[model samples]
Target: MVLNYPDGRLYSDDIPKKPAKQVRTTPPSKRTAQTQKKNNFANRGMRFEEAINESNAYYLSRNLAVIHKKPTPIQIVKVDYPRRSAAVIKEAYFKEASTTDYNGVYKGYYVDFEAKETKNKTSFPLKNFHQHQITHMNACRNQGGITFVLLWFSQLQRCFFMDSKTLDRHWQAQATAKKSIPLQVIEAESTEIFLGIAPRIPYLDALDHYIALKEQEHDN
Candidate 1:
């Protein structure tokens, strides 16, 4: 008896048993996963870090500001040198940050600040900040720098430019029952930053408003 398989194979039972389809056995690569995440971010909107960077670039190109993101300090414990030109960092740990995320000169004024994003809808958690950062901001303030924080409420798609001194005041009160800064307080004290197409964050505009308000307060 002879039989013809559905595939192009002629068979007695199956000529040789048609070879099984080769299925992909390889796992998805880490790079591929990272690329997917980046694509998702782009589709939704630029992430806080990316937005700030674009804004900083815009400022620099126009000679409006000279701000740059601070590179995190890393202590390398091990390095593999396959070649002098290629040294792979095998083991590394981040050192504690001594200052904020960004610092530079803006319109002849020293500008120093940290940028943070939160997923909370109503209040910003106190844990996102550190005592050392507060101290660093205080030191910068003492040096007559314009020190503040660029706070992003991701859930609400809202951004605020909060002065470091005001942040420190609330931070100190965290030892009491209050665990977070309410949205109302932030709205009252901080300058809201409307997202822009060119600069993205447009934080400098809020900074200008803050400066004017402070100057007015001083006058009063």
Candidate 2:
């Protein structure tokens, strides 16, 4: 019953406005072994996006909460019908993303977070986040739900759950301060998560930690 927009098209009585992202067109070609190897290592088993989708499914199946990936907003310019039932999409263009990647409900809380992976060893570049995403996270926080980002440091094989509040502070400080938030700073302020088997990112455990920490703070 709850309709949420992933890329920031707010639900309304009128049709949502699409983004301005360009769509890339690639001719059908054979993939080489070298390309396959690179993709395999980068993806590992299932892609990070797929893993998160599966994790969301796991969460949903048990009635924990409803979470879904927003479809890439695209405007179909052309389509061909081979049969009455089969329609081929020939041309489409991508729309802009005005918000973070994933969002949904958990234990009455509306959770919003973006999952980003980087090969860099030392710091997470500030450019990875869009300004609108920061604004979205801030709005979610104001709505009293949990808003944060999950950063996957691929080279180090480590992940961290950082509160959006801190990220906002650093994001706004870019003009005067350093452009990127270093690994050391993230290591100190965020919940460092160990990538695991069953749950992949095991973010719920980190969520538990965040909840507990918040509760303790509220108590004090």
Candidate 3:
């Protein structure tokens, strides 16, 4: 199967698969449970996007906010009908560049943000972002919407909420400065978000803090 972007660039989804490990068919044991516990703890910071989605679901259930991940628009070009009820898409092309990862309304303020994860220990690569996304965020901000990004440092198990304006400044400076955002700069400018149980990525707390700071600036 083959997929392509609107600009005719090849999009490869062919990830190398790891060899399957031998499975042991056995009944439940105390050691198995302990191993499971250790595995759960090890995966505490895995699947950053899933954590954000679960957090959104938690917020929605409690009537705290209405946020959702934006689905990528893809145009199907080829399909294989293996059975009458099982049609498989074999090829597709992206309709266009996507704006952001998530957007919604929180407390009457329009909230728009992108979620990104990086494995780097010291900095986040700017190549993770695109020009279209930056332009869209700026447009939303200009219209009085709260625009930001949720950055997950997977290696450090840390997350930060950075305003789009701050991101834009760094993005534009890439011509002269380093092609990445340093950890020190992010720590200084962004609000840290601590992970939780129900809402894994407790991002709204950071949002509230950002709103308070904006209000203070307005009053001053």
For each candidate, the alpha-carbon lDDT, in order, equals: 0.77, 0.74, 0.80
Tell me which of candidates 1 and 2 scores higher on lDDT: 1
lDDT for each residue of candidate 3 in 6-89, tens digit (9 for 90 to 100): 653323211111111322324346345554453443344237877888999999999999999877566788999986588888
> How high is the lDDT of residue 95 in model 2?
56
Candidate 2 on 115-170: residue-level lDDT in tens? 77667899988877878789999998998989999887877888899999999999
What lDDT does candidate 1 reach at residue 136? 94
RMSD of 1: 17.0
Model 2 ranges off by over 4 Å: 1-46
> How many clashes does the backbone of model 1 have?
1
- Top candidate on lDDT is 3
Q: What's the lDDT for candidate 1?
A: 0.77
Cα deviation at 19, candidate 3, in Å, is 17
RMSD of each: 17.0, 8.4, 8.8
Please list the residue runs of candidate 1 whose C-alpha ends up more than 4 Å from where it truly belongs after superposition. 1-46
Per-candidate TM-scores read 0.77, 0.77, 0.77
lDDT of 1 at 210: 80
